[model samples]
Target: MKRIYKISVAIVTLLAGCSKSGLLDKDTKDSIDAQKFFNTATDLQVYTNGFYEMLPTYTLYTDEDSKSDNLIPLSVDARVKGARIVPPTNASTKWVWDDLRSINFFLENYQKCTDDAAKLKYGGIARFFRAYFYYEKVKTYGDVPFYNKVLSANDPDLYKGRDSRKLVMDSVLADINYAVANIPKEVKLNEITKYTALLLKARICLFEGTFRKYHSLGDHEKFLTEAAAAANELIASNAYKLFTTGGAATAYRELFARNDQDATETILARDYNTTYGRQSVGYLMTAPTAGVYGIPKDMIDSYLMKDGTRFTDQPGYQTKGFYDEMQNRDPRLTQTTAGPDFSVYKETTREPVNLSITTSGYRVIKGLPSRDQWGSLNSYNDIVIYRFAEALLVLAEAKAELGTLTQTDLDNSINKLRARAGMPNLNLAAANASPDPYLEYWYPNVDQGLNKGVILEIRRERRIELFNEGIRWDDLMRWKEGKKLEKPMVGMYFPGLGAFDFNNDGKTDVFLRTDNTTPAPAGTTSIINVNQKRLTNSTSGNFNPMYSTPCTFDEKKDYYYPVPTEDITLNPNLAQSPNW
Candidate 1:
């Protein structure tokens, strides 16, 4: 895997030319001219390396889940709060296309290199990134304008309206398919490869398929079929598996904590090295004033028991205190959240869950670094972009939605992940016979008849396994469950105001009181004023993070973001999304 570093000034200048410029300025000469630069395979490699910048960095671990119910940050997200508005100008818009222009520029000029193999390799990579770029755009705003070639400032197409979703997605499909067929088969943890292309194809197809199905758009089956096929092909390749060397007790958490990417599971990742620069994931997730991200009680309730049972089915489950609730649950719950034995970097003693860091009582432990890499801009763990477990889930989900899923499919896909977690394999028949009510309640739109039970189970699996990985918001959107965001966000249960031991280690972890005038009990690590925190029952229920602030999800307009007002004004043909 190549360690991504700063690119040369020549490549930087070439990329800068793709920015907003007039017709005459578009052709202006730079330090290293584009015509002269595209002469060798090494040049192609150097130029394409810039595309990695398009991938996510530490934010993937810090607060990417804030938009979904899986996490609650100190400050609610504007989108979650239904506070999004149409920006006044393109400058304030996230709809910029300079990256697309750069990729298109490379595609147009890569033929200058006489080496056919090098051209095909780099060309495939360029198309993969272009597909990636468009996938995000399509997710954000449906029916965006699709540009294949670099447009000159005077080009008439610049004033045209948005293209049809079919046209743009079809173009994206072709680019990803070409990438899968032409990219090298070799596995590179930090570079795009055949498997990475395959993963992207599956992801794009699954999203489009589910989104179309749930949104009542036509032609949903084709995308689902393609999604299953792409995932199946990747699984059949035998190139990757779950990273289980650490065993069920530690493998899952260690996978994200390691500084290096695990070749067994990670298909592609953003490589970060201490030598280049430090990453801020540790500080962002663990610092009191930095991230302030917490796992919600609703999400915590979704994790199945160790013996493969729903935690919500147990008697008195709602009011279970922190220590009792964390007992004998899915190992992932302990791995992902700070539990009885969880300690911060370099600390031998188990740290109490600080409400100041996480507004909710649950602190996220996934992607947290060791003692040596704990401070601001000091961690360097490689953030995963694609992994084998997701591909498996995609395959299982696509098949289930298509009504072609079978027990064998479960054995091949979902069960693989369950095995790595030391949990029992999911039985298709049993799951269908008795669907989990909690899952069905959360995803009411999953009406696949007999397949509905298994589908809901798969969604639950996806939610638990992929929590805090930055995929929940898209999952909710694709499933047409945006209203879940409006549901109350709460944390650990409290019978009433009193000092208590959260980890069951005989030490008072927190004192819940009504006012500052009341002194906390001795040895209490933290004091949370229940009046300020706002419990659901006024004094005894779960911690309510949004008791004072109400959140809304507009079914009509919240699904798609509105275009910038100035862009719509500049091109009168371009129309804004409905109800913006």
Candidate 2:
């Protein structure tokens, strides 16, 4: 357990605030120093509060999904390209452990507090964050060294090798379990509670369980049971439920933009204040006008029809144009994208489809606020980190994977989410009878023989419900479906180079051409954009912006990120990840 004291001291002091004016004024009765800072309950709280910044904010949360199949970037990342050669000196390499030391320092020092209740409560907080830190590290680089306590500069344990995944995850489970049992039960806006710990435990356990099950690591059932039990505990608490106080179509969007004090669905959120300029670029980046990040046609095709039928099952589904295809689909589709009669600020209705705003025809509308509330600094809607819907998905998937699922369980978990969206309940018997063709194609790993149909449907529900919330990359990695990257990234469909009406509003929206010399149809109102290198094929008869070359993913190496080369050099005992 080697620790870098320079980084550790700066982080601990800034977070713990030992030298800050009034941080120690409450306990002037005792001497204030680095080692003596943990003498009071207030000290324990301030130290633990420092860890909240470790959680992902709104921008960071949504940006993560760009790496997955759900959202396509203006340009593909180097990590997602065909030949991902991550060097040892790559600046983006996530092969460090400063967060671990911050957490371990608290665990080692919180016990020094004389108050029993304060010690237990704050100790639980420390353990919970420790679990979070390690889970992220393991998810990024598998089998990292585990350290439970802060170490000195010359500690020999710092030279130790990587620990097994099982050993590290078991310790994570222990930490989360302690936090779940000892943490307070009060409902909070953004504070950790027993419910928070339970939801995280469910999330982490499900990830490990599915990873092991898919990668053939064994003992998957044990982790699945843990996931199920943790989710069940949170569900039984009766403190949270789906946000359904408004129309089903608008309910999902309102959940993200609402600033109400009572948010029933959200378990934990990263709050922001517009006046303080603590906002995210949710509107500017994801809006149809920005064009930086856009949702793909593959994700749009995944949504079920309003009647809960597969859209791909319809004849000529692939050939259907954008406006007609969006009709009678899931309500979430309309809410998520700029559909017909699209409006900002809920005032005027107009169809605005700017090709420059989105690479795919469909732009992101998930976190966009009203026109008056829309700005880089004024978008203060709280970003939800965890909510009850994830708990429902986790519970249902865990049970299905464990082969212990039933109609009653589906009714309790998946059915609740469906009802919120005004979609029909999923029938276990019908699902097991025949899995959807689209799902079977996308999630090829589910083809393995073990409750295939229900498992696939559960996965579908998870994707549809939690698409832009930034969990897709982890979901794909854990399920061993990274090969999805190889699929062609296509956008709005077109017959060929022609002026087409995307919104079907009796007006031309986009004018396609093989070259700038190609004239637009005489006097069309469509926006004339020249096609040079913008699309994969200027004359390929379809709209694919990123079709320069087909993408490829190496399953053997892409699953786990490479351990930084510099880190391996520093510690000769450390082994590089496979295929690095």
Candidate 3:
């Protein structure tokens, strides 16, 4: 196998103890040579991998930060203090305040040193990484300082912070442009390919440009047109195609499972294996005993049938509930969630643990350590940040918004995904799903010509295609429609393995619940006993917690997340998002 290699530049150290006195107490910065440090071939190896690994950790917004509360995951430590989601303090804001620090470092210094193809390669890597990082910031924080140069801590100009959303976006676009121009179109055999940078550009541009255009922030139509054009260029390249049939369960599932051998759709992935990055997010979310995390009910419902109908809306879906009900439902769902008797699983270790979910009711089998190696706790799987499938979706969305989704759009956009699944094209009119109808509800001025609804459908495609690969929070934020949609978190809670019974569905054999005891235990009276379910305080109104809870789209206030208080203090000129 031809392995993708990186240029490894060894870390050079400055002589130690320069602060003591005399020769040893000399200034360190003066003694160290900045130019030679970055030029080392060994430095690029570590730098490149570090760049790839950092993408997932970039947390302007993450699922945990957005879930339950507008802070990091509700930690056990905080709950003990009787306070929830420790408010944004200065320390909490370091990452937020300094997200651009590293990117700026590389950008300002990359070109000062070497033309040694090896060092220049790292330059290209840094450019793409910086742009990619800024792209994420734009998506979350709106306007940010598009710093292309490193700033000093003592620089008096630090107070000149904040720029309008448009400025940041345009600058972001420019960086991607530079990246595309400077980076290769294809990398023969390397960790980060030349084609990968181009693909990243296409995706970032289309997303930002379409979002601006869809929301009518500024020259949206112009950007959308340009984005569509870029997307089309990628489509015509034909270097990638849909991963169809024999590809279904095992191959399709393995694509994200991080087995590099099966990464057909993956354009750029954060590879973790033999090396301890992470494997099977399953254990983190599954019923613990099952050795993985269970999938959330809402996540499970996101997949569409192979025929494009919702699993619930399909024939026998209600009756069979879990029988791959709609033959048309996207195969990705099965690959993501565990079945009533989930079939596609591999054993990696020999320990004997409960693969079945006795308490939580459902468990995730995808991306878990292979079944047999029960004791092999760690599993290595790569997370795909950019994939060709996403590129296709972006193309379809931009084209649909620009005008009617042309025949080519069908072939390139939705059809490619369907083709991979051996399904037919969606007759938009026949499907009775009008793309423009949401326009009526979204904006009153039809002349605005903003068919954000089309973009929302594209957003929907994104949700289904890339379910819970740690993107639900940002995906919800990016869409004008999701921001507008009123789907509240009104889904049922499965407070798995706790005394807190969300709702007792015990009466119906179809569902399982712990039920309320006749006498009741201390601190457990909050639930009402009925059937086998206990209705808890989490559900108070019409929406049954025993079944589903509430998630409403509070348009007036919920759009932008609040800026961490610490960030506001450091950058006084920066303004908070509206209504935050």
Error of 2 at 181 (Å): 0.7
- How accurate locally is residue 454 in candidate 1, as Cα lDDT from 0 to 100? 93
What's the best-to-worst order under lDDT? 1, 2, 3
Q: Write the per-residue lDDT of candidate 2 for residues 40-127, one digit (tens) a residue.
A: 9988877777777678876654577777787777777655566666566635666656556667767767778899998888899889
Best by lDDT: 1
**Residue ranges of candidate 1 with Cα displaced over 4 Å:** 9-16, 19-32, 345-348
Clashing pairs in 2: 1-157, 1-158, 2-158, 291-357, 536-547
Candidate 2 residue-wise lDDT at 347: 58
Instruction: Tell me, by TM-score, which candidate is best.
Output: 1
TM-score against native, each model: 0.96, 0.91, 0.73
Candidate 1 lDDT for residue 428? 98
Q: Give the per-residue lDDT of model 3 (tens digit) for 170-206.
A: 7767766666665656633225555676667766766
Task: Give the Cα-based TM-score of candidate 2 against the true structure.
Answer: 0.91
Error of model 3, residue 471, in angstroms: 3.3
lDDT of each: 0.85, 0.76, 0.48
